[model samples]
Target: MTSTARILIVEDEPKLVELLTLYLEAAGYACHAVYDGNHVDEALTSFKPDLMLLDLMLPGKDGLTICKELRQHSQLPVIMVTAKVEEIDRLLGLELGADDYLCKPYSPREVVARVKAVLRRYQPQAPAAASTTSGVHIDETRFLAQLDGVTLDLTPVEFRLFALMTHSPGQVFSRDQLLTLIYDDHRIVTDRTVDSHIKNLRKKLEAVRPEQEVIRSIYGVGYKFEEGSV
Candidate 1:
């Protein structure tokens, strides 16, 4: 993540905002803050932050609703911070298009790390390092993807994740590692967001080659791709 990256902190507690600002600023992020959910949009427009650290329970509007509405037009990465530990709340937040969620009573350092992780993922980097993997080929220059000579329609995230795993066939990539392969550290997400991406990518691969299992999930580990002997 760039040191010039801007961060918007949304929370009701003044002390928490101060604490976060202290840590985030030290980590080289410029931060703007809002105490109520109602002020989120105005701040978003004016601040134009690269990422947002949103508190789930706010005085007005609330995080889930704000997130849902934001997803309608913005791709800004949001990391929801909340005290709610319920499984449903986490699922709801993810469903609402939050990039990641952070449970409250969290560490300031972890918050900074999450901020870096999400921003790193959000920012566009150079194209895939390696192009071809067996029958699957990616034309980074033309931005084309093909599975066994058939064009594959994939989202950008799916494309990058696909490129990473296929580039290193048979090598394992844990969820976090896959999220930021360009880096060795940084926990991008706590949940199985990576699994959902892998699932979608597998479906696409399945459509072209029904009998071949190109992507393999290792139990209790992570995911890897197999070229399956030319």
Candidate 2:
């Protein structure tokens, strides 16, 4: 069984907050609840939660401001919760470095699932030798994949995709499999989503190293990483 993870619930709605706290505790997570945005700094300093479930609409300071402040100091995973379902709001949260977002009227179980997924991505792993033979070093500690001394600034999704593929070079993984690995709730995702993320990741990689195309797409199949290539 996985150990209990600490989570902070930063929502203003009392009833919803209680529901979330109860559900998270039942799911074997240690939870700390705060109702006002003004208390975020203090809670962050004291609670030191593994993940934060932040609501966009708060009483004092608004979620976006708090998110920006937190990102300046720490890369701690944050999942934004908002009553607004607009695409702009979602994009803004993602751009501000949120690991994930949950729209309001959501299931507590789904929230727990997302928290677990984000934790898995950000959690530290033991040191391992790089598989790349070209002196490329992959540092899981800093969430970086470097080749020939050039580092790639990958998003959370991109990093996870790269890590999984590099672990088993030359082995193909279907879109469904990759989706399940990256996201906890794969039931709602389509193959197109995976394709889009892969495209974006490739662009990021190409930005740093024009010649390196580690991830390869198989016609009518899926994607795989080249052997000995990081």
Model 1 error, position 226 (Å): 4.9
Tens digits of lDDT, candidate 1, 1-230: 57889999999999999999999999999999999999999999999999989888899899888888887777677888779667434454244656667787999998988788777765555765545677778866455678878987665456677777777788888876775653224544443567766777788888988887878988888888877733
List model 2 lDDT by residue over 1-230, tens digit each: 14488899999888998999998899899999999999999998999888899998899998989988887667778888878767434454244667777888899888878877788776667876665645346677766676557776665667778777877788999998898876675647567667867887777767766777767899888999876554
lDDT of each: 0.77, 0.78
Q: Count the backbone clashes (under 3 Å) in each candidate.
A: 0, 0
The worst-scoring run of ten residues by lDDT in candidate 1 lies at 182-191
Spell out the clash pairs found in candidate 2: none
TM-score of each: 0.66, 0.77
lDDT of 1: 0.77
**Number of the top candidate by TM-score?**
2
How many times do residue backbones clash in model 2?
0
* Model 2 per-residue lDDT at 64: 88
